[model samples]
Target: MDRFRDRQQAGERLAERLVALGYGREPQVLVFALPRGGVLVAHPIAQRLGAPLDVWVVRKLGVPGHEELALGAIAAGGGRVLNEEVIRGLGIPAEAIAQVEARETQELLRRERFYRGERPPPELGGKVVLLVDDGLATGATMKAAIAAARAQRPARLVVAVPVAPPEALREMEALADTVVCLKAPPDFRAVGLWYERFPQVSDEEVLYLLRVS
Candidate 1:
């Protein structure tokens, strides 16, 4: 498959696929993007669907030192899901998990404040919510986001991404009412690999996108 020119292009493609799948005309649709990368991808989708755009902040509980390796993740509204296999395999103690959780929870709140400001999060009850992310890897953060969304009693929950591994999509199927993945290459590595210009999306960019919409 050809790599997307950038996140915006990937999002456009995802939006097209989503519309083809019968989501474009839904009146109750709401787009909850996982910032900061998801914001760029979601803005176009929101515009195309004429839906409200918002952020769903989720923080990874990274393993000590090896910060890229996620032990689990925590999302807004006190939703947390830990990877027990990773924890036990790494011999991470309960105390370590608690510490990591505390730290991540703080960061999650900080991000929420930074992104949404004084505005309370939008109510999801009875809404068909679309959880947008640039891509999925370990899927920990997305899982936590799904849990948090479930707490709000949305009428329907869907997870959408431009690219993800086949295995990750399979795992997400049981969590979300629908999972829309554009590309699930067998040799999938990182999400960036499928994009020609996967730049680091800055906070300023996220703020601009949120304010513009």
Candidate 2:
């Protein structure tokens, strides 16, 4: 496919692919989406697979003075992953990393509260967990999510996305039990580039999708 019309279309395509791969047949399937964009993309997957949907809140830890550069990421339930190579190469101090992590942790907690409210988190133990995201760029946030999900002892961990660069897909393959990606274009620039009508997903949209799902 050249490009998806939007996140919904991309999600429909992914859901179809997953069904073909026999994921729809899996009995104890649970879908966890990374908000706020991933939730929209995962809605169709959850519907197609007849699974419960939940959010896995994660926040990226950007490098000091260069926010775009990801130093690592943190997930709900206190799961975290840091790139020692990046920290060592950039000579980032522990204090700076601590400060960034603290700020992100607060944001993660806020999202968990706002998106989930009083709803208890899904039970992942012995369930086939399909962790869905809109797409992967650096894969830092997804890695953190995987780490968090692993702690819950899911029977199988699958990372699914609509589009990603080849290198990012390869990295994810090593982390999760299975990785399903629809398109891995060689000239991949960004996740938004793979969708023609990409737009910023708002908190309101996230709330609506979660409520319906």
Candidate 3:
């Protein structure tokens, strides 16, 4: 709990641990940060490795009545991952997905413009793509992100984060070539609790980081 005093500190710590993990040269590596908080953790990492840092926007589909529960998630490039189990068992109609998609799609486009401006996403066709997020909770959103990224045909996919529940980490491990999470608390309650400073990352910050760093 006292390991990091704040998000910046946590980012530094994660970078140090990652450097030790030996993923190789920063310039050659392609690092994708999930905005907006993930960018905060990833900036230090990108700085350390001299890698080009960019944001990968992904949004979750909240269940119709239970917003906290993820019914599915969607990512860029027509990438989608649906909880088939929920859809079949809970009887979520297509109308529900359509509604969620409409709302989430608007935000996704807005974020793309807000975070990337005119810059285009880097090529991931044959490079090691390191996906960074502040932390993992339900694993739903990241799952969609990873699946979305994989469609771009990156040679390798790695998931990096500062903290996540052990179960979530394990689920992610199978989805990615590797996982570089710094801490896996058994009883991880929430991503915020793991961080000493978990302030809400702003839209301007995401745009700024993508532009300069």
Q: Give the range of the ten consecutive residues with the poorest summed lDDT in model 1.
A: 75-84
Write candidate 1's Cα lDDT for 29-111 as tens digits: 99989998999999999988889899999999999888899999999977789999999999999998899888888888999
**Runs in model 1 lying further than 4 Å from the true structure:** none
Which model, 1 or 3, shows the larger lDDT? Answer: 1
Model 3 spans with C-alpha error above 4 angstroms: none
Please give the CA lDDT of all the candidate structures. Answer: 0.92, 0.93, 0.84
For candidate 2, the 10 contiguous residues with the lowest summed lDDT are: 204-213
Tell me the TM-score of each prediction against the true structure.
Answer: 0.98, 0.97, 0.93
lDDT per residue for candidate 2 within 1-213, as digits (tens), equals 499999999999999999999999999999999998999899999999988888999999999899899999999976799999999999999999999999999989988999999888988899999999999998999999999999989999999999999999999999999999999999999999899998999999988888788
What is the TM-score (0 to 1) of candidate 3?
Answer: 0.93
Rank candidates, TM-score, best first. 1, 2, 3
Model 3 pairs in collision: none
User: Which candidate has the highest TM-score of all?
Assistant: 1
Q: What TM-score quantifies how close candidate 1 is to the native fold?
A: 0.98
